[model samples]
Target: MSVPTVDLLALCTTIKAWGRELGFAELRITDVDLQHAESGLQAWLDAGHHGQMDYMAAHGLKRARPNELVPGTLRVISARMDYLPRDTATDWRARETARLADPAAAVISVYARGRDYHKVLRARLQQLADRIAAEIGEFGYRVFTDSAPVMEVELGNRAGLGWRGKHTLLLSREAGSMFFLGELFIDLPLPVDAPVSTHCGACTACIDICPTQAILGPYRLDARRCISYLTIELKGSIPLELRALIGNRIYGCDDCQTVCPWNKFAQRAVLPDFDARHGLGSADLVTLFGWTEAQFDQIMAGSPIRRIGHERWLRNVAVGLGNALRAAPSEALVAALQTRIDHPSALVREHVLWALAEATERS
Candidate 1:
């Protein structure tokens, strides 16, 4: 159904206003065309850079073609939500690096330390879409947050949300890259926003700082070597060669964002949903190590950490513990691995054995 010409501009205006009310910091609309990103995506998939993320390749060109994926999708309404906790310690990155240096400290990614964003973002996007339906009557639209084959970052850039940074993350002059992106694909013909100019301009801080050199070059990242993909996405044994490079990052890595100059301007989420939960912001490894499978489920019930499951969580923490043991032998660190020495999960047991050996070698 053709949208009335008179309602086009009004629809965009109302959407942006309602988005702010829903606690999204920024909103922009983009056309369904993503031909430009298609080639790059194909190349990345062809090179097997996505590792075991078969879904990325499975989507094919549907990821770039919005209307094809969602019938009648004429435009994409892109939104960004800032996630930095307002009260996060001043030297957060420094503290994380120090934790890597120390063997006993367990380092969880800053983003996963809080509630899961999938539920938070998906709910908000649905609310935003629902409100739009109220204003414009029932419409054909679908809300997505890190779901399916959506080219979220490309849409964000096309809608003028921000430029894709050298680290392959969306970065905004106003809010940096410490944010989550969601999309609302609608059949209405909304005016698309022009993309902003990139500002990386000779800065390679993220590339130089990546512990695994995941950033192969500006605007290119090999997910196979990324710590985040390694710890959370990859389900098999932690590659021994890259295990040492994983450092103390157990859940995910934010070093690229933490080191980016633009993130200094990253804003805090207007909604408290994104705030740190359960003191995960500064949790001790041994303390996290002691959590039983039941405790892990209970504490991480509504958090993103739960998606990795107890076994993978233990596997990652074991890698961190091994690295820590190598750096500074500690009875406490060894003991933590010992407790899990006979874990039923082979994944966890293998990592624990490796960590114990590392501690013994250090001693």
Candidate 2:
């Protein structure tokens, strides 16, 4: 057997350039070893901070060890793609705040409003990998985007992509936390980039603005209290204690990112894939709650929001309606909850009843 030689130094330069051409905001290389992240991962699982996201702990140490996850892995090509729409207005953050205040408007996460990023990033990353293979003559590589056991934030942090913010998401001085991270694990011995130093300083804007106080402290998050987990991840019932605090957030919540001071510099996506679809950015709560399972499946055909399915989707919207009712009782909001009171899913029916109760008590 003959050893295939590679010019690693030049390969690193070529890979980054190709990544930029592939619509990635930035790309950096890092070694596969994640020994530094293992303890933190274990500690989080130990504390049960992951809630019902059993997948987070299911992969065990493979989540921290890329070499174990994909044998023979040497380097991880971490790529960042900013997800904000290219046409996002300058006052977008203010607009988000205003929407939240409206009580009747449904607030889906900006990221989920677009095409499923998993589909977009995975396909693009595969292209990036194939392009590398074409240049380097076949390489051992597997691309991942928010998939499997890989710890993307740690990889992105070590690859000099960004520092992990107080809310436990990667935030770049140039890109904030509004970006998708993908990794191309390869056996090539590419030169590694130095990690970016933490710049969160004493600023606690993200923590202060967290609707559920999901951020226990800097770099510490309790996902159980997180609205995103309650709405999207938890399958059974939402804890009643946190329902009111969830407010009008029907999908994922972005209060932390929206309030972050560094987010002023957040970059918009180079590709149009993330542009808000179906008017999700300004959708009314009653409107989203009225979506039949078929309507949800059809309209969210290519959206990440569909992952929660119409059942959880209704559950979340019901919570938002409950909050809206308490904020100010309205016949439209009450009527919407009544329509779902007999929903086929027990979970949806349970939430619908609660939403109606909120209106009853408040009125």
Candidate 3:
């Protein structure tokens, strides 16, 4: 059976409209010519900046060649979905900064406080692709939302969703960096949107404010030292040197995004999926540390944090408890550490023992 021909330009216009109807804040199309990003990606990989994320190096340069990854791909549609919760307060930034100051608070990154973005964006991207197929019969396309080897930021930058900020995240003057990105690689010869000029200017707030100095310079990030990577990506014991620097950020860190001046323009999620769950926005370290494996599993269901599993979840909360102990000794905090000190997993026990030691050293 042959696919019917359609007006590509008009179809592009209709696709964008459909995307808006489906909750995507903006959608733009760009040809799959990521040749410009290959070298920088190679340099980042060569420097071992990706840490234990071996998957980043697994695909080699296929990551920069979308057509190679998805053969016959002619155009890529990049979509952005703002994730700041719909009811986010105007003083949300100030509140986040204060939470970091309260040593007993468990600071999960804002994004992970809600449902997993991977599930949300992948489903929506597929819906958009289905809508396109309905308009022009069948089309060759694949939907991706951080699950593949594709260079999402590069594709998004080229698609004019936003320019890459100094922190190396795609930033928009209109919507800032508080959003998720997804790509629809399709065979359609849709007109491509022009790349937008970067607006970072002389601002270095994101780099200067990093707790672990992960942002080495303007755009360089050393993930091994990053609090987010240390708390979430690393499987073994958190490094002794970087453990204290991890502070109370148990799951992920949002310091770079929180301080980025562009985030003031960050829009709220039009969809409810991104809203905080289980009071995670204001959870206490001691309370979170007390959750049994079953409780953690039950509470964190449908959350991005669940991917880390109960053991790593215990590992992270122990680190936060350790940092909290160092800040101010609490019998409750020390007691929580004691309960986990005999945990079956050596990984959890090691972090728990270290946390208990924090209280002793503080005294």
Q: In terms of lDDT, which candidate is stronger, 1 or 2?
A: 2
Tens-place lDDT per residue, model 1, 26-141, is 89999998999899999999999999999998869999999999989999999999888767676766776776666666777777777788898889899988888777678789
Q: How many backbone clashes are present in model 3? A: 0
**10 residues in a row with least lDDT, candidate 2:** 1-10
- Can you write out model 2's per-residue Cα lDDT over 190-236, one digit (the tens) per residue? 88999989999999999999988999999999999998898889998
Q: Please identify model 3 stretches exceeding 4 Å from their true place.
A: 1-4
Reference-based TM-score of each model: 0.97, 0.98, 0.98
lDDT of each: 0.87, 0.91, 0.91
Clashing pairs in 1: 103-324
Clashes of each: 1, 0, 0
- Residue 317 accuracy (lDDT) in model 2: 92
Q: Which runs in model 2 stand beyond 4 Å of their true positions?
A: 1-3
